[model samples]
Target: MKKSIKISLGGLAFNIEEDAYAILEEYIESLIMHLGNTPEAKDIVGDIEARASELFIDLLSGMQTITIDMVSSVIEILGRPEQIVNGGESNGQSDKKSEEPKSTERRRLYRDGENGIIAGVASGLGIYFNIDSIVFRILFGVLLFANGLGAIVYIVMWIAVPIAVTTRQRMEMRGENINFSNLEKNVKEEFNKVKQNMEKRNVSGFFQKFFNTVGQILIAIGRVFGVIAKVIVVILAVVFISIGLIGLLATTASIFFGSTIVSLFPTFSGVTLAELIGSTFDLGSTLWIVIPLFFVLAIPLLALVFLGLRMVFRFKMRDTVVFVSVATIWIIAVTLLAFVLFFQARSFTIRETVRDKTELILESAQTSTIRLVANANILEGVDIPQKFFNLDDYSIANNNGKPMIMGKPSFFIGKSTSDSFELLILKRSRGATSQLARRSANGLSLLFELQDNSLVVDPFFTLSQGDKWRAQDVEVTLLLPEGKRVYIDRSMEPILSANQTCCMSWPDELVGRIWEMRGNKLVEIR
Candidate 1:
């Protein structure tokens, strides 16, 4: 039989055999010294005692018998003198305090913590959990980071947990003995009044009214400012987004239309590459613009009117009228601006000047001498057969040493011009250099100068979104059927001749040879 001795460990009333109680107290005290006399370690010791009780009961096997050796046995099973300890977590709450925010956080000090940069509650926490202070600090730092909220929360914690000045206060902060005698049987219970008081978060009486009023005012002001700020931010964001969209639309139009779009719409007459580039495609049209305008202008005014009505039914319409008047003015201004923009985009087109040209000539000769003057070497020394002007599209004209007496016969046509003409005669293909005749064409125009060089783009071709075609006049001497002279004008005769369009041929031996009326004599360009 085990006789019970009345003793208290850390203020917890315990009835155990004399030897068991002494050993238990000694063991718990040792734990406290090691755990910095914190409330958490005290809690762990209590758990150890309870566990020992159960172990002791199991050993007895149905008799209400207990033994100190049984408690020692439980201690050994738990591990070494240091290892004989467990964390201060209570029944079924091992992960709760670590994971979730406690209904009451572990503040720096007792009574909701005061004057401590660190959570004194955490220190007391070390006592309650019987964990190391360093462990708690690391754990807190990690939790703070993992939460993803900024460091403001940690600062809040620093402010909330109290500092422990006195030894008793420190103990209380740890949920330990407020009075040394009451330390054990759950010190958390002893601080119930303080905890409840902390729950209400009652600060000094002097601060109470002042803070309450200040907080209320601040909240009201903040709400109003927040409303305005949110509105502005949304407005700005919408504008930015719209601008980007409009720009994209313009660029897409510019690429596809090129000069064509400006050619079609007269409303968009002034539109250019710059206009296309500058226009923002942001379509805040119809509902997007109108709905927002209604709300922005109406909400505040309605609220004011409602408040005024409630205050005095003597509801003078003057202020409401004033607001409406101002809003109307703004609306009119904006609408006018929109109308102006709409009107500006009317009708448009794109037309411009072009000057590059090429001409081919075939002439009649009286002698058998190879007359490859203009066409002689005209097609040489120039970039031709370009993709822009498919040389395959160019028509071949043959001018043998005979006039129109032989219908398209007597000499083969094989030659080609640029700024100056070079004509050659084509005969049976010997596949040698001697097969081609020289001096095959005569100079046809004054400014043209027997040019065989392929047409180069006019350097000063002016491009515009307009349409106009001016006609040019050219002088020509023609060979008629009666061997007489004939003058031609495009205005008078749209077609120079049904079969012959002022024909010329290889009638000269040198390049740039011009024909004169000095009894049908041809001369070379000086």
Candidate 2:
């Protein structure tokens, strides 16, 4: 047994054994010597000693006396000078002033040691906000409704806030200075909790069975959702790949016949057969002849990639770095081959480009309403903002189910003065590749007639984007007045989220295209 000392470190100090004191001094001196007898020794020495002191206390608590080896381990953790000197930025006043504040008086946000789930995030929040932690959790949980949004928010908070451990930190928790010892205590408590949990897992019978059952249930739910997500992703990928492959097949078929004929053609010079073959060799046909063969040869190689991807998924190839490297190389090679094809394909004549100019056959044959077909696949790659829309309030005009008024470009509509105006491609916020073609076609169904001497969109018209029926076109046979028998139905999402263009127009155009759902009084395309 050794006597405790009342030596002060910076400002905070507690008793220590005489032998412990000697060892601490020797360890600090060795650290100073390593840093050299320079002017910056004061700064370096103080940091190393303070860190060493904390380490020493930690070592002593864990069933052994503090040793020089423990101090060296602490030094190793602190590291040395780097591109930016880490610890020398602060001084005596900065640190001492921090310690001067009484514990409870200093305000702080910390992970709570008591009344916490993982760390003390909720407990600390409850303490700071003057509300019960349970209440905050319940509120966010209710808002998220088990959609995992609360979990995301909780995780973000955990990563952001540090746990309060020092006595000063406890005071800071009560609103005080950060206590180093308190901080360490919180950390120790956390590690202990983990240890306890591991012990629980290790124990046999009763509580173990109960916990295992709960864990299994959670894992099952996670797996189910994971499987559903994976399936959807695979389906979407297959659809996209199918589209690409169809193009590849068409390209291959064209070349196959061409190559066969080109190879089998009788090369009889100065003869009737030669003359006939020469006559058939037009520039367009000759080019088409070579292209199909190129596609056929290239198409089979794509299978290698599909096989690689399947192998990666099935065997957990991602667990090994070598597998990842090989997969990456495969991808690069495939990409380069694609580039070559694209270059080779440039010389091939294309009939599709001839028809690239939009064939707009717009006429008001019917008078009820028109339909717009928006090609939303072109807009899928973009990440839409959560709250970029100006949608605030809405009233379902003819929806069949409870309408959702939040997220994305919200729609708002109002009672028509005359009648629901003819649906038209008013204005699109964003899209690519035949952006307004669908809208122009679908929203212009002259199926709407002059109701009360005004052109209106036909009822029951569904405007779909990427196979999602975002809005339906209803024929305006009767006046859709406020509080009328309007039906709003949510089309169960059977595909990836639809990125239909922001269909906002006829705002204040009392008799033009009407979108009352987006809160537009009357939006008209200028």
Candidate 3:
């Protein structure tokens, strides 16, 4: 319950206890009396008061009142007024230096600008942790691979850490005594460091003049190239922003309105664009997939746009809060997207194939030629146009029951070991396991009928309902006996395998032509 008084020192106000105020006031009077009433003396006194005010502020921290102990500590740090002789150290300073106790002030973190290469962060950390700066430098270099985390941390530290400028500050930074002895030693060390740096830079030989000329020329060239580099950077930034914006807009549109837009066209029937995209990869619910995907696409785009704007405007963001928040979110989004992709990848790990072979029934046993015709009525209920159907690998179709995935089957001709003609339908699909793959492959249905010697095959094969797409494919191989002739209908041109027509200049040339199987190869009868 001590009384407190309000006072102003060095234009900074303070609420100090009565005892501390009396001590501080007497100390100021002693400083004024020691150095007479000169302008230089006044300036020195003002500086001392300013330093005392700062010490008081640091001691107070959250407290509102300065105590006698705090005043004593400040006086000790600044030194007693009797120690000054002609505004400098007195001869008695050395005699009393031995009686002064060592300063127990904890080391304060400050950037060591004098011994630093780049902003002094690593050197400051080295001083604080009592380790070599090279270790921190190496750690930062290694962490640069972790999404440039080192650069971010370095920039934040550089912004937040203050450089040690004053002798007292440097002393506190090293946890050294703050008395006159240590202050004087710190000043000498600073002077020696500057002298050494100057000595290294100062050269008086003819080589110095030559090197100076070369340096000047290099600097001049650098200025010219710097402008060009800036222009190139601006151009690149513009390109990045444009690409980011376009990609972001396109992704948003695809997620929300893609199904509506695709419905206008006659490309896919009985399914929306979202369903088609979902069919490609199975990732739980649509929301779970969309949220992570949106962030993964949009965050990078937004970051690119922000970077470009920053570059163009030449503005700086000192507060790292916004940057840190955005970076954290971006990292989370990337991790989630990676997880979703990994989970979906498991669905296609195993591949299984199912095959079916049926003997072709001919009405006439004496018929020597088989005419292969394409059935156009296979897609009777499906509303997709022929041009659109030809372009797609798989599409959804109404199969009079539920919408089913259908794809065109590839056709090839092979030599049969038996005299009778044979047809093989090989269905291939992928799944998470061999069993699931087999199930998916077995669900495929291929339609074909033989009337007399003429064979009609559907161009498309379908997957049963409730089965998702897993790279389902169907191959139709006709095993023909040697010397058996077959005629290909023009409608079958779309389903013919490219390998069978590689020798022909045009794939459609195989249509409407009679081909004879000779020695496991189909030879065109021109």
Q: TM-score of every model?
A: 0.21, 0.23, 0.56
Q: TM-score rank, highest first?
A: 3, 2, 1
lDDT for each residue of candidate 2 in 376-440, tens digit (9 for 90 to 100): 33213322322111222211111121111111221223343333432222222111224333442
TM-score for candidate 2: 0.23
* lDDT digits (tens) for residues 11-45 of candidate 1: 33345676776676676676567557655555556
lDDT of each: 0.37, 0.41, 0.76
True lDDT of residue 301, candidate 3: 90
Candidate number that wins on lDDT, 2 or 3? 3
Candidate numbers, best lDDT first, in rank order: 3, 2, 1
Clashes of 3: 0
**Model 3: which ten-residue window has the lowest total lDDT?**
382-391
lDDT of 3 by residue, 1-526 (tens): 9999999887788889999999989988887776566534554566577768878888977677999999999998888755544434544756557656676778999988767766677898999888999998889888888779998787667656777877666776787756433454455566677779897875557865674565456546656777898999899889989988998988887776665655575444345446655656675666666777778788889888888888888773443677788788878878987887798889899999898998886787777689999898976775554323222677665455344677888988777888888998899999999999999999998889997788899888887777888888999988888898888889998898877632332448778889888886778888
TM-score of 1: 0.21
Model 2: lDDT of residue 43: 48
Reference-based lDDT, residue 499, model 1:
31
Highest-scoring model, lDDT: 3
